[model samples]
Target: MRLSNRNKTPFYSFIYSLAGIILVLWLIAFILEINKFDVLGDKSWVLLFIPTVMLLFLYLSGRPIFEYDSDGEALNFRNCHILFLLSQNNAKDEFPKYKLIKYNVVNVLMFSTLYVYVSSKKSNVVILKYDLTFMTKKEIKDLKFSLNKVVKTNGETSKDDNTVID
Candidate 1:
């Protein structure tokens, strides 16, 4: 199965999108009122950063996706299962940082709707969260089984660098 958790039309996402837009608009209004369109003061400029950071947070944490393909030709690997993140930081193409086997553990932290957390090998503890939906009960069991097998088998070996998608 091929799936991406991104809701392109965020209008249906309701709370999240509404919050983002409302916050951004409020910030813009605040800046306009304070700065008077003359010159943005230092503190007012800092206020400008709030909305930008909020939007970035919304973008990054908004849509967590899970894509599974038993057939790995699309993913560029034939047999092994790999985990990677596709980022939209770039304007043209998505920048992926799943290389170098930076992550070590994959744990199903929350059972309801299945929140999968991927953490790095280092101590700073960067975690990638996947909020998965659209999966059937049996599929979730199979997914849990497969991910558990990967964790049990790998155990910080960092062989994940071999994972790829073409």
Candidate 2:
């Protein structure tokens, strides 16, 4: 089944607006500085270097991958890893038997990024590191609901099929 393309996040637009403002201001400042400084008179064009690099990084990192499905399991994700996997069985004892989620967020400016993960059977709290931006509150809530539904429906269907085998 195809997931709906509904973004309920109220703050996403605001955040994007803020980023735009910051980028614009930075570019203007760079231009004004070039006019006053003769230090790089021969290479004043370097003033546009920083903002150009930033915009390029943002464009690459912001590409969104929203859905994944394989072998009867499916996942709906946002602002996370480009690739992921889901399964009902775990080879290790420490691994829990429930939905597993993992993703990486690349932070270009800082020269660093973070990987985050969650499990449905464990506490609702997420495990994360590094300073990474995420989807708005509403988007996260909706994504969680969608993932939970996928897991529940798959589990129920498997149970019904197993009963017939016995």
- TM-score of each predicted structure versus truth: 0.35, 0.37
Candidate 2 weakest ten by summed lDDT: 85-94
Across residues 6-112, which tens digit of lDDT does each residue of candidate 1 receive?
A: 34334434645576687778787776868586455555666667777766655544233345432332211111111123243211111122321232222343223
Clashing pairs in 2: none
Count of clashes, each model: 1, 0
What is residue 159's positional error in candidate 2, in angstroms? 1.2
Stretches of candidate 2 exceeding 4 Å from the true structure: 1-37, 41-46, 64-134
Candidate 1 Cα outliers beyond 4 Å, as residue runs: 1-16, 35-42, 69-142, 147-166
lDDT by residue (tens digit), candidate 2, 26-145:
677677767665576667666577666765665444423233222233333333332222212111112232444544545465443334454654587465442233444454455446
Cand. 2 Cα-lDDT:
0.46
Clashing residue pairs in candidate 1 (N, C-alpha, C atoms within 3 angstroms): 75-165
The CA lDDT at 101 in model 2 is 57
